[model samples]
Target chain A: AQTVTQSQPEMSVQEAETVTLSCTYDTSESDYYLFWYKQPPSRQMILVIRQEAYKQQNATENRFSVNFQKAAKSFSLKISDSQLGDAAMYFCASGANSKLTFGKGITLSVRP
Target chain B: NAGVTQTPKFRILKIGQSMTLQCTQDMNHNYMYWYRQDPGMGLKLIYYSVGAGITDKGEVPNGYNVSRSTTEDFPLRLELAAPSQTSVYFCASSQWTSGGPAYNEQFFGPGTRLTVL
Candidate 1:
């Protein structure tokens, strides 16, 4: 079975600063996909970014990027210039075949 | 387009009661899924359907049932609700190609909060 883990239960960052959220997964399959999803208080699950295991270059969308180390089975999300809107629960998810597995998640709070 | 929608945004159920959570997607996506979300625990897949008439159990399938009769609707049923089953339920849809890409990207709907006493 595939499993995802986010060690941090909660994280706080000052506005305009940078914050990194860590994630790790256990999967026997060589090919898969990694993702970071954000959920605000509205209970909406929004996709933040995604990384393919086959790609060596990290994926970046605006200020959100990932540091994926396949050998170490680590995938971390980096948010730059964090804003108040960035305060939410961030989840790391892994998908292979038709199943998507999610971590426990980290609650992020931004301070102005 | 209304990508995905779930009815009854919030529901409170009594123990041993039964209810069906309705989910509909207008995207005509080939893949649909039901997941339960708990605070600090992220989300757990309850069931998934690759397409109409092809449903399968996921990690936490116990106490839940699902059916995909059409391409657009995948309703989840709880036969006898328990306190443990009280959580937010989300309906998600996506398209899949044989090789990659689409297989990983999923569109999620606003979740339905269910409380079982």
Candidate 2:
């Protein structure tokens, strides 16, 4: 069974600061994908960033990026220059063989 | 595009009851999925459909059922609702991009909050 783990239950970062949320997964498949999703108070699952297992270059989407180390099975998300709107529950999900598995999620609190 | 839409935004059911959660997507995505988000837990896949008339069980599908009669609509049915079934249900859809990782990129719905007493 494939599993994604986000060790941190909650994290706080002051505005304009950078925060990195850690994620690790165990999968036996070679062809896979990783993703970060943000769920706000509205309960909407918004895609923040994505990474392909075959891509050596980390994926970056504006202020959100991911350090995906395929061999180590570590996929961490880095949010830079965070804003007030960045406060939300962040989820790490890994997908392969038509199945997507998610970590427990980390709650991010952006302090002003 | 409306993306993925789930109906019955909030519902409360008694034990042994049954209900159907409606999900529809306007993006015409071929792959649709059902997931349950428990309190302080990761989203668990309940079921998924690749296209019309084709559906498969996911990680957690023991107490639930789903059907895809068309590409746009996939409905999830919960039978003999138990307290453990209470959770936020999300519907997601994605288009399969050949030779690409787009197949794993799923767009989620607003989610349905279900409570069982």
lDDT per residue, candidate 1, B36-111, as tens digits? 9975688999999999999999989999999999999999999999999989999999988667652458899999
Task: For residues A85-110, write the lDDT of model 2, one tens digit per residue.
Answer: 99999999888866689999999999
Per-prediction DockQ: 0.66, 0.63
| Per-residue error (Å), model 1, residue A57 | 0.5
The C-alpha local distance difference test score for the whole of candidate 2 amounts to 0.92
Show model 1 residue runs off by greater than 4 Å. Answer: B99-102
Pick the lDDT winner: 1
Instruction: Give all TM-scores, in the order shown.
Output: 0.97, 0.96
lDDT by residue for model 1 over A6-104, one digit each (tens)? 999999999999999999999977788999999999989999999989999999999999999999999999999999999999999999885789999
Candidate 2 docking band = medium
